[model samples]
Target chain A: MLKKVHCVRLDGDKAELEDEIAEEVPLVIFVNGKHFSTAMISPQMREEFVTGHLFTEGIIDGPVDIESLKVESNTAKVLTRHSTTFLESRKVILSGCGSTSSFLDKKKLPKICSNLMLDRTMVLNAMKAVLRSDNFKRSGGFHSCGLFNESGAIIVVDDIGRHNALDKVIGFGLIRNLDLKDTFIATTGRISSDVALKCARANIPVIASKGAVTTLAVEIAENSGLTTAGFVRGNKMNIYSGGRIN
Target chain B: MLKKVHCVRLDGDKAELEDEIAEEVPLVIFVNGKHFSTAMISPQMREEFVTGHLFTEGIIDGPVDIESLKVESNTAKVLTRHSTTFLESRKVILSGCGSTSSFLDKKKLPKICSNLMLDRTMVLNAMKAVLRSDNFKRSGGFHSCGLFNESGAIIVVDDIGRHNALDKVIGFGLIRNLDLKDTFIATTGRISSDVALKCARANIPVIASKGAVTTLAVEIAENSGLTTAGFVRGNKMNIYSGGRIN
Candidate 1:
């Protein structure tokens, strides 16, 4: 994306109307040359998006299943050849229901094993960091989510949507070859079932948000043994489940 | 909507988060009980939503086709069977693109009309008022869109997603039995083609936003003869097409 913006309609000093021409990048994900999805995203890291998308969608059980990957035009083309071992695992083809109602029947919730004791201060600070540095704050056109570890330090990535933000971070971790086990994710948006399911896909343990959590989201977190937190403002929050700082 | 929320994670002595739970309201459009699409909307304004929906979709060529109208909630239904004189028309089904893209193939631009003029003061002022009162401002939740008259004064509603807000206003207008012709819609969200299409469905002549407008949206607005505006702020905005200020 270009850093400079020009106004098309100027009523005063402010841009009442502006002409903004952006350079578009392509993210092509090819499942064995059979294209899966094409995403137009920031070109900072292409492989992260591809790996994150594949892993989140359960296309590959482990990173090794991905035979080859390519990133172009900010587009990440993930190439995985047909193999019985990969196919027999039964990946549920989910209609992308990012943070909304899903088209498919709800899958069995993810069961968590590693309960993460959240560092509340780290979360609060991370949230402030997110707000202060948000691209949306400048442009008012983007959404983001963040991931953390037990220490509550900000890790992972941010994107245009809460789902995309989380996906980018997961993808980043995959490209850099990071661990998925016992990770925590924090969002600047609501904790709906769609988000919860995304966390489950990553095998994340603790999920926190600067916004509200829905009833079904809480239920999913509980059933999955995932620690859910919402409204994590400075020095305060509501834990929707077994996630409590010990 | 409920006011005076108390959340443990809220800013100290500051505004709380705004949350509006969605409910299914039966919007029965009885074109001779032929059963138009079952619209899920707020129950408060059954009639207005129906009329606005029908008009925007270009279903009725002026409101006189209907012989009578009635609205109901759970058991409430709208008996809107049109007389045979107007029976020559069938409701146009405008469906959004499939879920994966969730974006319209916007390159297919609509025909542009050059006759629409809006009050600049009204457009900017309406945007200010709606943004000033957003749930995002108070509870830091929800997105908002406002419908404006050719005069530019905001008439109906605002919401969480760009789509939901427009729907609420449509639902509100439909229930109140308002005139939707020669209207403009303003939003704080990105103006995608789907967003443009939604406004087009209502036959809204102009669509404005404080955020970005996609390429497809520009095409749709041009072809549909809808004026498109973007990057609306204090005193300035970008007029994409079909929008002229007198």
Candidate 2:
């Protein structure tokens, strides 16, 4: 998923040639033979991305909601339960590149009823693990996402887009039938409303990151009963919503 | 149009409450009274966003191509010379959002044949200025985009997305009829192929950032004859393409 490219390194008066970069590719999705969406993503995790994208976009409920998902070179064809009826409508263009869905309804977030409490140490460890991943450590061009329980990070995924990282981990949880109600997510991107809302829709109660948290994200998380935290560096962090951290 | 929100801070055992979070809003754009695109943005620079988005997406040629632009609370209406005919087609979704458009063509970039030699000091200073902007320094939620000539950063824009920031500065340049041949862009987001291609299409020869540059971005910049640089910090930087810097 990562690649190296020749580059010139300039450190003040000294200059050297090196190769250290990540790979990005355009992946177009066709739902039931109809063009749905196009994403510029890291070449890995196509299936997880499709499942997570479909679920979060409200296109399909879960992995089982699809009859078949075939990923060819840079393209994925998903046959969802709603494919035929959904394909009748026009393609809805979403706002940004992380995860764009025309079906996102922020006002109608699914109620998440989880009593999960996040441990600061676990969150810190998860954040650290994302930065320590081979993908990030090697190329530093990917965003990392970690799904954690009470103990620690269960799985970590790195993607070119932070939204896709969250989706991959969440989709992984959904596929494995993990009890997401008892789980939380730690990512390496800013806490935007879109990110927080994704966790809310996925029923993941806690969203932690080592980046800034937007006000809309805090409001949505607070209303939707999701814990939002950011700037999870070293031993300090800011909790924007949900129960106060001890 | 930034807003402040209250948040909780945690540092081990001590906790404090603060209200220092940045605001984010969804802005939907309509071209010729038809739905064009929707974006989650910082709420300012809607006109610039629309103009830049239309131009970058190949919807419009420049500011002159737009007859009028009206921005409501959370929506932007654009009347472009090609809006009527363009609205007849379907909406095309692009990957990752800073102002994503369906009309971007990467393989056919406009040739940039400027004899501009990037000044190491100028790039360094521009990067620092973006980080030092009040929006970034205060909220840290906005990505900064700066357009620089020989004098210095002529215009710097802060947006929730790096792509939007780039569009804003470029849009500003277009509206003011600034000569882009001698200009460059400095940003605070990773150098993706989409980004590098946008600058290449806009005929901006130099793209600098304090973030990682992807492999595709390097290849695209190299092939498009645009200079690319990344990891621009305190006293060191990485120049990926164009000319070797001393």
Candidate 3:
């Protein structure tokens, strides 16, 4: 998902030509033959993307719920029992109830009931592991994610888009039937309410990031009973929500 | 769309609980009462977002095409003559052409024919102006944009989302009837293909950023005939595409 291109580089009054770049493609996803959404992403691990998107968006419970996922060029056709149901649900929710109502409802989402605990040192190491990935070091365009537990970051993935990286990690978990409730998610993407909602849906109790945590994400994390930390640089971090951190 | 939140700060091994955060919300757009897409955005510039989104997506030519924009709570109702046409076009394109062909078609977008030239010193100053904004200095969460020309940065806007920031700048231009072809866009967000496409649609020839540029963005800029540069920092930059820089 990359391409070599000649670029003019300027540094401290010096100029030189070089070749480096990662390709990005617009991937339009269709659910049950209906258009869902479009994302500019790297053309890889698309099935994981479809599965992760459906599961995290509350469209499906797990990867088993996806009947099929077919990629025709840049488009992904995802089939699931709830494919049409999810679309209808979005329409009903949007047309019937106001957008703010839905926002409030999600904000008041059920608390994630888990007893997961994370060590500061371990989480810092996990953040370091994500930062050490070739994708981050090379492209600087990709987002990275690592699923962590008491042991450490067990599964790691990267994608052109931040949300896609998290989705890939969740999809991996769903396929492995991992106990998500006890899992902690470490990522290199800004933590938004969308990310918080996804973690809530997956029953993830802790989320740590090497980036900033927006206000809504913090609120969602606090309300949903998830522990979230941001700015995981070197040995420092900020826990935005939940009080279970040690 | 901001809220106050209490947070726990950790430096190395020390921790302190405090308050510091900016809010985020989901803004759902409806055109002619039909549900469009939902965006996670800062709520300040809903109308600009609607107008810019329409203009940049090639849905409407400019702000003159929009008849009205109404915000009821968190939902934006945009009224445009091309609303139905745009929706229909998306459906037809997605269903009829599939995905890959459309992707290729966009990738081969014609070169921007504008002969606008930008000086390195002026652009570096523009980037500095964006970084000096209160939004960037205070929140550290908002993405910023500054519309520039021969003189310097003219209009600057900030939002939680990078796309929204660019939209605000474009909407500002549309309302004031600015000559967009001669404009240079300076931003503090990653220049993805979507962003490149927006500049192409606006007939803008120069896009400079203090962030990374994805391969797709470079390709789009190169194809769409726009001069694009990234990693504009302290007296340095890398021009990925186009040759309109002096």
DockQ each? 0.16, 0.45, 0.56
Specify the highest-TM-score model's number.
3
lDDT of 2 by residue, B1-246 (tens): 467666677777756576576677777777887676667777777788878877877788888888889887677888877544443223333333222122234445567778788668888888888788888877778898899987888988888788888888888888888888899988999998778878876889998898898876776788788998898989788888888234
Error of 2 at A194 (Å): 0.9
Best by the DockQ measure: 3
What number of backbone clashes does candidate 1 have, counting pairs of residues 3 or more apart or in separate chains? 35
Off by over 4 Å in 3: A12-14, A81-83, A86-102, A106-110, B1-3, B12-15, B86-102, B106-111
lDDT of 1 by residue, A203-246 (tens): 77777787766544555666676666677777676665654432
Interface C-alpha RMSD after superposing true interface residues, each candidate, one decimal:
10.4, 7.0, 3.4
Error (Å) of candidate 1 at residue B91 is: 22
Q: Lowest summed lDDT over 10 consecutive residues: which window, candidate 1 chain A?
A: A84-93
- When sorted by DockQ, best at the front, the candidate numbers are 3, 2, 1
How well does candidate 3 reproduce the true complex, by DockQ? Answer: 0.56
Inter-residue clash pairs, candidate 3: A2-A23, B111-B224, B111-B225, B112-B224, B112-B225
Regions more than 4 Å wrong, model 2: A84-107, B84-107, B244-246
Model 1: DockQ vs. true structure:
0.16
Q: State the lDDT of candidate 3 residue by residue for A1-246, as single tens digits.
A: 556677887665646676556667777877778767676677777777778887877677887777888887878888886535543224213223375546656534856988877778888888998888886777666788889888888788877778888988888888788899988888988898778888988899999988778877876777788888888888888888886667
